[model samples]
Target: MIETINSSKQAIALEDKYGAHNYHPLPVVLSKGEGVFLWDVEGKKYYDFLSAYSAVNQGHCHPRIKNALVEQAGTLTLTSRAFHNDVLGPFEKYITEYFGFDKVLPMNTGAEGVETAIKIARKWGYEVKGVDENKATIVVAENNFHGRTSTIISFSSDENARKNFGPYTPGFIKIPYDNIKALEEALEEENVVAFLVEPIQGEAGVYTPADDYLRKVSEVCKSKNVLFIADEIQTGIARTGSLLAVCGNCTCEGHCEKQDTYTKPDMLILGKAISGGFYPVSAVLADDHIMNVIRPGQHGSTFGGNPLGAKVAMTALEVVRDEKLALNARKLGKLFRIRMQKLVDTYKILKLVRGKGLLNAVVVNDTEKGSTAWDMCIALKDNGLLAKPTHGNIIRFAPPLVMTEEQLHECCDIIEKVVREFEK
Candidate 1:
């Protein structure tokens, strides 16, 4: 058997030598994780504030999801969509019912789910809306982080993601996010098939839009006959105080269509926490009319609807509902913001705080190119809490939904102590 590596320095050195230089992760080397805490290679524990970009909203290595994965692995893992597995049908049915959709097309990653939705929308535009061949356009927002795929980066405004990556894909229009007038104007263009947006722009430093933004978007898409696709991969699954960010202010535990705040999309794309970070599982949900456009063989994946992922996803979602994670996130999120707001009032280093539910970010009073936010995060890690900076000067804080109120307060104390030290 291979010898186990015990030193954090050794692990970091190994990764630096063998791995591609794509990610600049925090310096801490994690070895184990539980509900709201992580242990480093050196036996130090820290609060997990990032939650793997909201992928572990149900918590790390959750027992229910793990049990389902273990049981499914012992039976059947994958049949490659060449043959039907016993779990796929049940998973599709359960997920559709859970989200109140007519059907669900399962995939393995958030990027794959996004690609699937793009194909479906384009096809529906051609066959149903009668858009000219090769003329269909999908509108997306500026500064949005869908994924790192080539097609996704084609429409990206981030020069770092787009530099030297051309010739970029066409048939996409970029609009300023949270601007209804710009959306209305863009919808006036011919062959605009859909408007794809994140209910809350998570990667753009947890930028929550206007409260009525999604509701208005739904109305505009309906009027323009364009598909409204909400990419809730990061903001869904109770991350933003509701089952889905599109649920808006609805207080229900699950998707409730009758609620006034509910802004139903033509197509919904979900991933990340859909499997509670135990496995890679994503899905696209739509009604019969829009989804029926794609016939057999037009789209599929070898591991898309595999038995292992399906079972884990089902159990993960069940945990979210049974534990009332949405309600918990809603309650704790308010308390977190209140605590952070006090820091902003007391410290000159902080500029402001803005977010929904547990997904929050604090803007540092420094330039985007400054290292103050990075330094603060390093200090936080040293103080036994983990967080990361986004857009240079903003620090995002998103713990697991399973985090208790007492743990949240303890984490807050750590953050406060770090801020005090940094301010000095």
Candidate 2:
């Protein structure tokens, strides 16, 4: 019989002994989660502020999504792309219509979705845009966090993620984020096929750009005849108070192409919360004109369009729409910012607070090398909330979107109490 682990210390030791040290996770051993709260092995319950990096926007173990997974699991889990599955067709139709895209190519993870978008863009460049073969180049923003794949990391400005990971893949051009002139200049190179960017720089400490940045980018890409790819893995599915971060300030429940704030991208890459943290599911969406460039065997994943994932993702999206998570995120986000701004004004330890929706960040008034942000997160853990730091000094707070206003106020109170005690 297998021995059961019953303590946080034991769980930590088990991971330390066996797991790779790639991630320096916060020392919290979670055993169960429901809605916006998690229970440690010791039965201590705490509010989950990270929401698995915005993958649980529908909250943990969401019954609707969970039921979908279970029902599909018992029926048809996967038939692979070699044969058609009943769920894949419906899912494709649902998601494409949901996002106002002509078609969608399903993939398994956010990184895979990004990789698929890159492939699609390059193919569209060669077949559609007449870019020279083997010379199609994609433009990316500096400090962008797409994924850790070799090709994705090749253009990364973070040396820590890039160090010793070369000789890196070529054909990528790096430009400053949120700068229109720089993008125009890069597009002048003639070989630039696509401009890929995050709607909001989530991993780079929730760096929300100017309101007009994406709108202007859309115009520029159209004029230059280059594909504009929005990697919304972290910011999509109502996490940024919109269906997609590229939607800007639009309050629509679904993709509204007619909305003025909607800066539609040529290619949309979505993942993370697409399955509500229940399973790994991702998608790359585009219109027929651009997506038709992909031919059979050019790209595929075995688990990409599996039936179980399809059902779960469909239900997950339904939850977001039916519950109007985007509206909630928008209202709660305003409240969160107001609460955080007050703390920023009064506390010397806080530098500033910035973000949209529930994906806010509080920058500690210390250097990037300082431990203050990490220390504060630890303090929050002890006081019944869990958050994590990014870029050393910025602590990101993205709780489940299902969080109630009363619960939000309670969490804010905990934050205030922790800050007060820490300052003393």
Candidate 3:
């Protein structure tokens, strides 16, 4: 690896030469990271405002989590569900109890967790909800970012994500986001089994719905007897300042509080921070009826419940509670957004800054579709804050959950400088 990666430029050139051009990532070659900061190959440092799309909620290379990974790796790694591993059972117990779910079906990626949830929901629809065999439809919100799986993209409303990707999978119907009316209308069709949605559409530029939108949607799904599935891959694990973003409360505050209507979801899909930025461990959690519906041989993964992932995830959850990242996000997020709003107020090029918790985005002036967001990201990079664009005109700014006040201020300073310069 050392002989091959002699320099960052060489690595970048090698990737450009050999790898697929699937992602148009910012041209910074990160070499090391800790907490909320990262260093490029040339030793130039930048505040990590993206946090691997909210995967590092526990921070980069967290010590305790790293210890767990190292320890478990030395003990046991993969046992492949053919036989039960000691760590998997205990890990599942901790996770389900922590999340208040009766059981958890683990997977290696957010997208796979989503696929598992879809399978379980469809099966439940057939067996429990009583939808027709193959015709059972799952309602999804337009512009939602679930994952990049084929079936996921089939229901996607984004033209770019869907073009040339199918021979699409059927049985998903896209409804307008934030519109309770569209959801209600969709549910009018009896084949609706579940409604899969992101609490805040993160990849679509941290687009949060109206305050009561979640409550209203949950009520609609409840009234219609359809399961409410929350794809919290990006928004879960305190990214939005709650255990789950759909919990509707950040900072444990009742700001998202409501009657019994807004309290729960039938299926919860989690990833990113589940392993504390260590490995790719994701899961689908549900109560007895929904989770139990999956019998042996129904669903499984090679690395899903592996001991390494199990230990890492358990410690990761503990670190979140021990470090109080949720409360920190609540406090820092308000400051971050408030500071960005001030920048927005002063800058002519920025349209608005909006979000909940650390998951936030700035709407750049639509100069020409995607140009403004890309240029602004480049500017932000130059100014020492690292963020990326979602759509053409929106740049999301999500720092690590372990971000400190001083570090957040430094990032905000960079952003302010970039916007001020952009106004020129």
Candidate 4:
């Protein structure tokens, strides 16, 4: 057997020899993780900034969530839908209440949650909203990263994500993001069920829509009788300085203060952090009318709301609230961006920095012309910070919510150090 001391090297070798080469992940073999730090099999430690693509919002292996998983595992794991378990109902109630939705549908992954929502939105369109069957159209945004499901990829404008993946799902319309004019025009089309979007397009380099975008879009959806579904899988769970980015400060420029108005999108899709980086736990939430449209057998997953996920999701949510992660994200995010801007000012290759809350990005200028968000990411990893490039020229810096002010500064220093080397 391969020795554990060389586990990372051995694991990578095995994966290269056997696993499909789908992802081009940074060459970092993690042995264990806690809070915002991960250690390699050789015990070299690094600060994690991507936070598992915003999945580990409460931080890697949060103690409370880990405990919940342990205790629940020893109790009940899966009961399926044939017989309900003890935790599903409680998790449903806890989450629905937290997000201010009338009902909740639990799923295992972000994409699964999105699929559940799409199904619910279409049903709502036909049964309640009174759109004709099989004619419901959902509006998505260009450059939006909803998920990689076939139904999702059908509307994706990205060539890489959609290349050769066909025949694709239909009934989705792609529109330019942050353009209220296009959205209004699309809403006028008949049989339009919902406007499914991310509050802040995370995979698109943490692209935040124009200020007042969410509230305005919410108004548009309401006036046109189309559901506004926010796919918060990456941007929710306090990643964006709020319980949900859509909620904002409840007083921020783009957000709605009243629970009655909070862009409360007809449907709310959640995943990732819902399990605090443990088991995959996703949820779809909506008003009764919208949720009621999905009949039981029509939508269900074997591992969707199993007992283990339920317990993990319950505790996972509690960590976000109890830790005041939203406040921390907002406060530290501001500092991080400010510090990044300062670094940008001192370097030419580092072109710009922009983002909201803790989900931020730094644009790298091309040696020839274009931006270099990717090359610098390699340099960043070498400097003991693990971040990935988005598109080509944008590198996102999203640490776990467990990051402290001191640690944030240290990460900033590391970023500044690596970025200065890129300056030509």
lDDT of 3 by residue, 1-424 (tens): 4454657788799889989998899989999998888998888888898999999988889999998888888889998999988998999999988887889999999999999999999999999988779989999988888877899899888878899989999998889888999999999987999999998988887889887888788889999989999898888888887777876664452224343324578898999998878999999999999887899888888888899998999999999888888888888999998998888888878889989889999999884365978988888888788889888888888899888888888788888887888789
Candidate 4, position 219, lDDT: 93
Instruction: Between candidates 2 and 4, name the one with more favorable lDDT.
Output: 2
Supply candidate 3's per-residue lDDT for 161.
84
Q: State the lDDT of candidate 4 residue by residue for 1-424, as single tens digits.
A: 7545576778788778889998988777888999999988878889999999999989998999999999999999998888977888888898888888889988898988888898888988888888989999999999999889999889987789999999999899889999999999999898998999998988877888887898899999999989999999999888888788788555232334455436567788999998999998899998888788777689998998899999999998888877888888999999999999998898887788888789998877753234466667778888889998887778889999989999999999998888777775
Any runs in candidate 2 off by more than 4 Å, and if so which? none
Highest lDDT: give the candidate number: 1
What is candidate 2's lDDT per residue for 1-424, written digit by digit as tens? 7759889899889889989989999999999999999999999999999999999999999998989898999998888899998899999999999999999999999999999999999989999999889999999999999999998889999999999999999999999999999999999997889999999999999999999999999999999999999999999999989989998899899878789999999999999999999999999999999999988998999999999999999999999999999999999999999999999999898889999999999999889999988999999999999999999999999999999999999999999998888778
Instruction: Supply the TM-score for candidate 4.
Output: 0.95
**Could you estimate the TM-score for every candidate?**
0.99, 0.99, 0.96, 0.95
lDDT of each: 0.95, 0.94, 0.86, 0.86
Q: Which stretches of model 4 miss by more than 4 angstroms?
A: 1-7, 251-261, 367-371
- Deviation from native of the Cα of residue 213 in model 3, angstroms: 1.7
For candidate 2, the per-residue lDDT at 347 reads: 89
TM-score (C-alpha) between model 1 and the true structure = 0.99
lDDT of 1 by residue, 1-424 (tens): 6648889999999899989998999999999999999999999999999999999999999998999999999999989998988999999999999999998999999999999999999999999999987899999999898998999999988888899988899999999999999999999999999999999998888989899999999999999999999999999999999999999988999988899999999999999999999999999999999999988999999999999999999999999999999999999999999999999999999999999999999999999899999999999999999999998999999999999999999999998998888889
